[model samples]
Target: MVGSFSDIGATSTDFCNFRRDLLAYISGADAQMVVEDMYKNKEMEPDFYFDFDLNEDRELCRFFWADTISRKNYVCFGDVMSFDATYSTNRYKLIFVPFTGVDNHKQSITFGAGLIAREDVESYEWLLKNFKTAMGYTPRCVITDQDPALKVAIPNIMPETRHRFCMWHIMEKVGDKVGNALAQNMEFRKALNNAVWDETLSVTTFELKWAKVMQEYNLVQHRWFDQMYKARASWIPAYFQDIFMGGLLKTTSRSESENSYFGKFTNHHNSLVEFIMQYNRAIGEQRYHQKQLDAKGESSFPETKTPLAIERQAAAMYTKNIFYDFQEEIWEGNFTCKITCKTNDDGGYKYTVHETGGNIFENEGVEEIPGCYIVPRWTKSACAQPMYNVVWKACSNTQGGNELRTIANQLWNEFYNCMGLANGCPTEMDIMLSTMQELKGRLQSARQQTRASTTPQSVIESILNATAPAEIQIKPPSVAKNKGSGKRLKSNKEKATEKGKKKVRTCATCDRPGHDSRNCPERKALPDE
Candidate 1:
């Protein structure tokens, strides 16, 4: 069990249990009861909010729920959230998505949860819309993975909110997209990570550092690098400095912790009603622990180690655990931060952190254990990227004729992302224009070479040896039974076990019950005589 109970939702189950138990909930009236009970609870406590969607058959297709306490928590700590469908933890195999955030204690807390029959824009849209209704306001920002559906839905649902991607999800893809060798290179990893996570860097400085990393690694021409670079404003911390995402969730992976928390309670073996019971139990444990911490934070005071009012104020403001986090920062601030760009603005002074050169905290052992969880979200610009990768290895002898087309397509897409050119700095524009000119000149020669070296391998117009679908469209034979109208099919073992015992035959002359007619005792005696 996770130490924090309010961290996640449940959705993990094996296939056998899913077919039996999940079907029972979906096809029967039990699923409706769960929603009806939620409604009755909502009526009892007006703060309780629940919404669901039904299919043509009136079966439950999706469910979203946030109780009174959950809504209250949202009012306190719902500025930024991380939510995802954890692996199935219910017998029904519905996707369990928990809307999780960090509380004042810096412990993971859940604002709401949802169960969806499928992962799609419609389901995500419904969940976000209900979340807004329950909370009675849109959050200032939200953090999520680059889920295609979510990328499309969040804007439509909450246009005012800043949607940012989780750095953890993006970093997890590094090994696959950049190849294991480069991904495993510690120097490259650290440089790239430092560039992306440094919230203190200004946008121009970040762009330059990112460009330097690409050049150092000879990844200036890499497709993935270009795509990520153009879209950096969406996910990178430097771009999201205005949003309070780092302030709220800089050190927490609420979704991961939440999954761990709820996993202890909900499992695939649970019936719909049983799962609800377990969910309640888990929430109760979480709330109770949080309350205990709140009491400790309020009643008990830690011994002040210094005369600094900031340190003393932190102790007063934060919970015991969060205060420890603050204390650690206070000790480390000597190396990381500096008062720079200080000037008098209007009636007061404006102090901005130094934004030029390398990040001051880059290599000071300041990066956390889970570097990815601390960052935030996506650009609408990359929403329609082709799902397929045309991996045209240009150096290979096995070149396709359409190789140049793919390259041209990538170039065109990148060029199309230059919507900010009119407002960009003159130096940046000069650099971009010069680079494009050089690329165009080189690409013409490269295209000629690629076309000349193409092999004449004939591509098939159709699947010559296509196979049929794996499953048979057939039904089992029914067994004939005296009592039942529709008996189940009997197996070979059943037939063998249920066969009537060999009938005893009467002897021909003595009418013996134990002997067969062909082997009668009188017949045997006559034959012997």
Candidate 2:
């Protein structure tokens, strides 16, 4: 493209420089709204909330923000959040903390984000408080790694919130904290995995299995083992079976998933402004993927495996990805499930489903899905539920009445119906495409006519009043202290196995043989190993 510019009577450097510094200026009192005036535009509480603190020298110190869409997402999926702080996402080494949750699509959705100059209790407290303020309520549950600062801050900030450690984070450390021989032993790994992940077992049974595994592996006296056992209530499913998010994320941690998802658009060398721009891109991509899944759920349906009426109902109710899982359960229940007990209840007859080598379930009815309890959130209709729409309407600026809203919704419905017609009548696609093109041209022509009808003085006023960008006085933050944690500490064997070589690991600070860090070290120290 730069080379082609020469043919168009421009040099490469000229094109590049012009493109780099290009700006559009708007100015004057008429065009600009004061912060106070904007705040007064809404009578209700603001849909967005952002807060930042400055140091004694008036430089950026800590910041947190959540937008309208994110806050709306919180209203729907805010029952659970997976949070962890990451570093090296900006040049000043600010810790990037993202509060992420799972949506109806079973995909990660960000609730809010923060960039803190420090990773201490004070900084985290400020960040969480801002998040709570933005979303209007605390999440019912939160999953996080065992961060020291968060351990102190979250409970103090939101005592009612159910806090738990990520099981995957704990499981990842097994090989690191334990010796290589035990870690490599398939029998030991299996025993430990079964002990931690088997929710079917009772709390006492889980404890017994854990004790047997620890005893067999000679890890009972290990410091790491002891700490894990002490915190079993936080991560172990046997202890928190009633938590709505326990099964969704306890076994497979989304903290790491959120980290990787946001990590794609950020880097250690990014400036504050650069980081914000890229962060927006990351969020746009995240929401775009969710939209694609939503479209797929609406337009497609998977074929049922069995001829069961329940399967057909399930296929209609669930999204494609979750339907596969439901299908597997329905298929397996045919063989593995047996009715062990049936008892009468006020509402209906309650029967106990005894599955082979799994947790027993007390469900209503025998085979009909309508009579049984279903998780509405996992269904295709989850996104369309009127409850969430109420939240959106409350926050929205469009203060239209029910009739106007219905008409607006009908426009979209008709648009989708057209798409369906196009799909159903594939042979007429060429005509349909031509009709759409003609409609687009007509709309553009109408828009141009309306713009041309505007008074020339109005356009002249805008051009005359436009001004250059306002100067910002705030300075960037100094490099600050971060938690310097988050990633699992990989053992020598694990690292070698992953990289396919026995490389010499070294102390990052001293460069004495052992670690690579994305977040650079503040000071030199010996390797913990």
Candidate 3:
């Protein structure tokens, strides 16, 4: 094309410039049309949304896209979100931001996306505002890489949401702060990981262990450790474990996974139009895979390793993926741990659990390691509270508490029947419906019995025996009278039938055969006729 243009009397310098302009026009026109089509069909595609900002030259700068399915997934599983704005792909240099979560099948789900011209705080705030508006609610927690501008903007916009820095992202940078010699130290890495991943540790315990490690490594003044210790609440699991996160996310791993998955669809050489096209294709495939998982989970139940009621209950209660997690916990709780002591505390029972084999929390230089997992169990009410917590209640202290204790003991027995401590004995709408059905059944049965008793065979037989056939009588045909004199005329068929048929003589007064009322012997003779 450039050579052809040069043959048409264009200068040598204009050759490269014309080629650039042609490519720009091609990519820009397609990009603009993509956004325009999304807007044009917004009414028909109620969930489809796209917004774009233009520079002074009316060129596309920022764009946001979210379909209806993304909005609904956010509503269902958006309790915890991982928003990443780090990936800069395509020729336009736009940063890709995806709102991601985990569905019930433990699959990565994209909630929404944004593309920005810049990575400044203002761009991030705009993206977050639009995402919140599209999703209709703020997530309970948001996890992201440690971006200084995002840290400032999040508290301003999502003040109520817990903003946490991703543990994996921070851990990946540990080698940069710690010397290479210390980075390769297996013991050092193990201790640091324990401090980061152990949610059961108390704040004081974590601080002590962290201090001991720093002292042992002779890095008390390390700037990275100093900053991390100061901002520990945002990254530490011990601080926010009690908060409801819906098991959706803990780090930016979901976002990284999404990027890796989407990488196949796009690259630096692609145009904006190609990027959008590949994005749709990627999202469609992701959803298709999730649907396949959903179908598999619905059709097949997870296999149980034990006959425990709680295991069965979990399989019944949770999705297939979640049930496996629950099953693993049940297996771990029974196999690797045991109840050390049970004590009464504040109208509830506290059970101390101790790990038996391969303790996870054995520190160096300590003679005996702490293996107890402390879990506080409290009874809030009489109603059977269904809570999804790691803590298990052995008994409650309340009115009729023994019954509750018996039930708990039964559950514990079933849970640990492999080890066997002791084996012992053992809605309102449903009630109303059962009662109504019972009454209806009884009423129908009574009506059937009454009909059977009232219509006996003897009464039916007597009525049939007494019934008699009725007698038939033929009447004489009447004649039409003449106008002047009382003369009569009759049809020939009627007159002949009347003459041929024998008439039974019956008196009108007595209604008896063989006697008219005027000549009856039983009647007194009239004196003067």
Candidate 4:
């Protein structure tokens, strides 16, 4: 019976009975022998400790610890830690994780353990203290979502760390301030992202880009971006190289991984101790596997490199077709043609060319291709290259050894026709003069119309001055009317005759509208005046 009670299937009651029976059985045994047996069994059992504790020296355990510690230190010392707090199933508890450094190539390293706390300060303090304690030093940088508690606690604890607000969080706030479409636009979003990263750009550049984005999105002044930019110096890291704490930082993904690990053990166990034991066992196995992998190679695999030759080949293919077509145009007289210039008043000429019996065919009223243009939108001063396509196309044909002398003469004539002599018709100064005259005429007409009509400002001011002193309108006191009684006015004689009618009065104490003050309890209780 005692043996059965001590078996693996033993209940709490059975355990108690087994202990009692064990005492009875051992009471007469050799005490020294029993003590030796117990000691031996205890030694045989594996040593168990918390995975996060400093004493966890297993190779896999060391790798996890080193990786996590490295990432946390990097984020703290270099990047911003964007933190947010959420509740667990347990009441009066909070969990905080820093969201940042997520990328496609590799997972972020700054992710650390989830912490529990009763209040904001406690939670933030716990996170900072644990980080410092684990890394054996303070971090130099921090980034987080704007939580008041974290904002307060960070300066108090890690004062040296550069604190930054998360751009994602800022964007969310902007969406709330503006509309969803503005926040989601690819071009606008790209511009906003670039604005945040552009170190060489002035603060005005940032403002201009922000305003453009807002205007494009049709957003009103929500002050979200303005407020964020006000604290920009504090939120963004000073250097891109320093942002990752030398590649040690990760975002809040570690806490998520921990949660998932915890879930596996928690769902199958009812007892807290049992759950903990199972969790540790699973962790031990994982650590063992990780250690084996680490010893053989690095924690992560190396990425493959692409060849430069392939890229060159691709670029060559894109530009190949243009060369053959240019040679054919040069063989025909159409390559070199004279362009005649029509002078405008603004000292500029509109250039046009008419071919005289050339093999080159001209299509009338042809719509311009999307990307191809005769003249580019803007010209660069440093560029020796011609802005007009006409020069390049003619030159390409000439280089192919098929240019007629007559066609070149015609081209030269067209160039001179557009550019008028110093005092003559096709000068740039004439074009400017005409444009100015047109503008002046328009302005004079606008002024005449403005003088004829009353301005809105004057009208508003006149109305303001003419208005009477406003008075609050109060409705006359209402009397409940009897449905059967027709609208009637009591004459002065009738009012005097009805004066003997019992008057209903409201009690001051109870606020009942029928009783007199004399019957009021509160009124009666007061001293008689």
TM-score of each: 0.58, 0.69, 0.60, 0.36
Alpha-carbon RMSD, each predicted model: 32.2, 10.6, 43.9, 39.0
On lDDT, the candidate that comes out on top is 2
- CA error at residue 16 for candidate 2, angstroms: 6.6
lDDT of 2: 0.74
Q: How do these models rank on lDDT, best leading?
A: 2, 3, 1, 4
Q: Mind sharing the TM-score for model 4? A: 0.36
Per-residue CA lDDT of candidate 4, range 1-529, in tens? 3246454454788666743543333222222222233333233322110122111221111101122323322333323333444333121122324333321112233334342323367556755665544444454456555667878888887877766555555554544454556656677668766766565556566667667865765543546665765676654333333444322232333334445554555442122122223434545565465345333332332221333332332222222222123224433424465555444535644545556665333333222222343112111110133222211111122321134656777878965665544246556767856875799789979977976796544443342222111331211111112211224576454566588585756677787876766787777788979
Model 1: per-residue Cα lDDT over 404-511, one tens digit each: 657888878877676376346888778888887899789979977885865322111011111222342221111111111234577454565576565655677788
Candidate scoring better on lDDT of 1 and 4:
1
lDDT of 1: 0.66
Q: Candidate 2 lDDT, tens digit per residue, 386-459? A: 22444544554453444576888898898788788888676677787888789988997997898878754455
Better of 2 and 4 by TM-score: 2
Clashes of each: 10, 3, 0, 34
lDDT, residue 129, model 2: 89
Return whichever of 2 and 4 wins on lDDT: 2
lDDT of 3 by residue, 1-529 (tens): 4247544655767666753544444432545445544654464455666676665655566678888777666656677788776453566566788788877666788988887776678878888878876666788899888988799888888888999999888887787678669879999999888877887888888888889988988879988889998999998887787666555435888888888888888876556655776888899899999778666755777789987776775565466766677678878867787666777767666666668764443222222212242111111110123222122223223434356768999977864762343233215445545766799789879977886776333333232221111321211111112121133466454566798797788887667888799877556454655
